[model samples]
Target: MSRHAFFIAGDRVVHVANPCGAGFQYQAQSHVLSPRAQVGPQQHEAAETVLVVQQGALELMVNGAAGYVPAGSFVRIPAKTWFAYRNVGDVAAFVLCRTAPPQPARGARKITIQIAAA
Candidate 1:
């Protein structure tokens, strides 16, 4: 098993934990979304995801339903559920995302899909 600690910087999504890097059962990522930036409209076929809001606010659209997620809050998205999020505050939004059973490495086998916006 590989184990190491690392730092994540910049205003982009960074995987903090993964099978290849940390040998963790789940994949953890740090996302820094600039104001008005959006992400997803995608679905995880076999992995459930949990999103923790660390700073700023976000508008989450899950399974076609929209809701507000403020700092210090979190949201769970079940497998196969379509989700998307956008920074709703003027400042950058920091979010910690974890997906269980770690998503397949890119090109291994597609377990995720990009869906059309509603």
Candidate 2:
């Protein structure tokens, strides 16, 4: 059997696999925030991402609008868009992040044609 690898806390690692042309599939490590732990403006050029809160409440600012994303809530971010989020409560905040192609089939078209008797 092959042994897979994993990391422990304090390592500040990013998991990666299956390199694409210019970028590899990447996942940032999950983090736990203390009361008022915060993150600032950040942007990405790759896939769109979502933040799902698992515990406690979180305040988020995307582009410029402000909103609260609490436990069991998800906030979506468009690719290449600037955004930021922070924990605003007095409890530990947990979040799960996922990235995927936005509008994967937007450029494709669908059509239907009718046949007439001559």
Candidate 3:
């Protein structure tokens, strides 16, 4: 049996899954955020990401307009488009993230990713 590998990066918990060895085209991870926390502005050059919210609420900003994403809903973020999110509710947000055309793993170095003030 194989154990699931995961790590924390900045404010997000990243769950690493098998895509290459499992022969899947997309890579998958589960991410969690505390109330009022956010993640953003990064683009996936290789794949279009799909985010499914399993718990709490998310305020997703794409192209400068923010939309509310509720729990049990899914959103498709296109490749290379800059997007950001915020958890507006008072509960922890549980989200499932998947990227097609799975890119290589990111560096393990601890780094803070912040979007410039607009």
For model 2, the stretches where C-alpha displacement exceeds 4 angstroms are 1-24, 101-118
Q: State the displacement of the C-alpha of residue 72, model 3, in Å, after optimal TM-score superposition.
A: 0.8
Question: Using TM-score as the measure, what is the rank order of every candidate, best first?
Answer: 1, 3, 2
lDDT of 1: 0.74
TM-score of each: 0.68, 0.62, 0.67
Error of 1 at 13 (Å): 17
Candidate scoring better on TM-score of 1 and 3: 1
Off by over 4 Å in 3: 1-17, 102-118
**Model 1, range 15-107, lDDT digits (tens) per residue?**
333446433345667789999999999998888888888899999999888999998887989888899999999999988877774455454
Write model 3 residue lDDT over 1-118, tens digit each, in one string. 2323334443444555663655445666777889998898678787888887878999999878889999888899888778888899998998877677544345423335544433
Alpha-carbon deviation at 60 in model 3, angstroms: 0.5
